[model samples]
Target: MKKLILVRHAKTEQLYDYSKSDFDRKLLPRGHKDAATIANQLKNKEIIPDLFITSKAKRAKQTAEIYAETLGYNPSAIKKEQFIYDGYTTSEMIKYLSQFNSGSDTIIIFGHNPDIAGFTVNLISDDLWHFPTSCTTVINFNIDSWKDIEVRSGKVELYIYPKMFK
Candidate 1:
C-alpha cells in the first residue's frame, strides 16, 4: 500500500517586498505555531513518513523544516522540488511521486493550495474546495507501486486542518 500525505504550507506574511519574488515570502508567527501544531499531532499519532518532499518556496520549506524537527527527522533530508512551486499540476505531482523507490511506502509533501487541493480531488474523487493553510489530507492507496496510482485510486484517510488543533 502507498500513503500520500499532502500538506499545505502554513500561513505566510501578506506583505512582501515588491522587489522580491513571491517564492521568497516567509511564514508568519502564526504559521510557525500552526506548523508545529500539526507536526506535534502527527508525532503523537505516530504518523511519520518515509520521505519528506516540499516546494522550493521559502514558506513551504520552512513548514517542512518545522515538521521535520518536530518529528525528529533530519531537516537536511527533506527533498525540494522546484516544480511544486509553479508547475502545480496533478500530473506533475504524480509524475514526481512515481519516481520514488518502492521502499518508500509513505511520503509527505509540503506545497501550496489549489494544486494540493486539486490533487486530493483527483486522487480520491472528492471535492475539497477549501484547503486552508497548514492543512493536511492523508490518502491511502491500495496499489503497491506509486506508478499504479490513478484518478480516484486513493481512499481518504484523514483531513486535518490547523483550526482543528486550535
Candidate 2:
C-alpha cells in the first residue's frame, strides 16, 4: 500500500505585476504563516512523508521547503519538477510519482490548482470539490505499486485545510 498526500501551494500575492513572470511570484505574508501552520499540524499528527515532490514555481517550492524543514525531511531529497508546473495533469502527476520505487511508502506533492484538486477528485470518490491553498489531502492506495493506482481506487484518509486550524 502507498499513501499519497496532495498539497496545494499556499496563497500567493494577489497583485499582478505585469513585468514579473508568474513562475517567479512569491507567497504572500499570510501564505508563509499558513504554510507553517499546516507543516506544524502535520508534524503534530506525525504525518511525515518519505518523498517530497513539488513544482518548480517559487510559491510551491517555498511551501515544500517549509514542510521539509518542519518535518525534518532532507532538503536534498525534495524534487523540483518542471512537469508539475507545465503539464499540470493527473497523468503528469502519476507519471512523476511512478518514477519512485517501493522503498518510499509515503509521498507528498505540492502544486497549484485546479490540477491538484482535479487529481484528488480523480483518485477518490469523496466530495473533495475544492483544494484551497495550503490544503493537504491524504489518500491511501491499496495497490502495491504506484503504476497500479487506478482512478477512484484511493481511500480518502484525511483532508487538512489551513482554515480548519484558524
For residues 55-121, write the lDDT of model 1, one tens digit per residue.
9999999999999999988999999988888866788778778888667998999998778888888
**What are the TM-scores, per candidate, against the unseen true structure?**
0.94, 0.94
| CA error at residue 158 for candidate 1, angstroms | 1.1
Model 2 earns a TM-score of 0.94
Residue 154 alpha-carbon offset, candidate 1, angstroms:
0.9
Q: How many residue pairs clash in each candidate?
A: 0, 0
Q: All models: lDDT?
A: 0.88, 0.88
Candidate 1 wrong stretches, greater than 4 Å: none
Candidate 2 residues 92-125, lDDT tens each? 6777678786788899999888788899999998
